[model samples]
Target: MAKHNIYKMSVSEVYPHYITKAEKKGRTKEEVDEIIIWLTGYTQAQLDKELEKKTDFETFFVNAPNMNPARTLIKGVICGIRVEDIEEPIMKEIRYLDKLVDELAKGKSMDKILRK
Candidate 1:
């Protein structure tokens, strides 16, 4: 797998890819946004504002209003690396998002995906 500078990557740029992945698998962008909101505790409006401003991942996470407490329960392999074992905090958070998107693409139910 290719390693890219995730911290420097734009959240806005990556978000569309998540929407496309979900949509291709019969999911909706609204569902994708809902998952994002669940993870970051950002309102849809706040997420929209961040996307409009084109913030980088570093900025996006740092400025998140209320990252969910249950996010720590998100565990699994993403890109062959176990998310729970990730040493870097930022990488772990990114992987959590990746896992959520993967679940959505795999047609997992919203309640289950959100760890409800």
Candidate 2:
């Protein structure tokens, strides 16, 4: 099977979309950043650097400082697929982020979104 093109797409390319999805629902960029930080364990500065460098999603995850163990608790549907059921590890990680953003846009409390 062919690798999903999303893996090669720059995180910067999709970052704006995540912010836009959140903002349209009255959420803030900082909240989105917080979710990302919680999931990837990237310090704010490191995240900024990755965005500035236009890192691809696969590399971004691969080089994550500390992928939160709690991310395994993220269970939901995204893009019509159950995140917890995804078989590909990288794809699962991507969908986990997507699910979190979806939850945020749907007005879930940050504590719950973070699975705290």
Top candidate (lDDT): 2
Least accurate 10 contiguous residues by lDDT in model 1: 1-10
Clashing pairs in 2: none
Give TM per candidate.
0.94, 0.98
lDDT of 1 by residue, 1-116 (tens): 44449988989999989999999999999999998899998999999999999888877887888999999988889999998999877778888999999999999999999999
Report how far off residue 15 is in candidate 2 (Å). Answer: 0.4
Top-scoring candidate (TM-score):
2
- What lDDT does candidate 1 reach at residue 72? 91
lDDT of each: 0.90, 0.96
lDDT tens readout by residue for model 2, 1-116? 99999999999999999999999999999999999999999999999999999999999999999999999999878999999899999999999999999999999999999999
Reference-based TM-score, model 2: 0.98
- Model 2 residue runs over 4 Å out of place are none
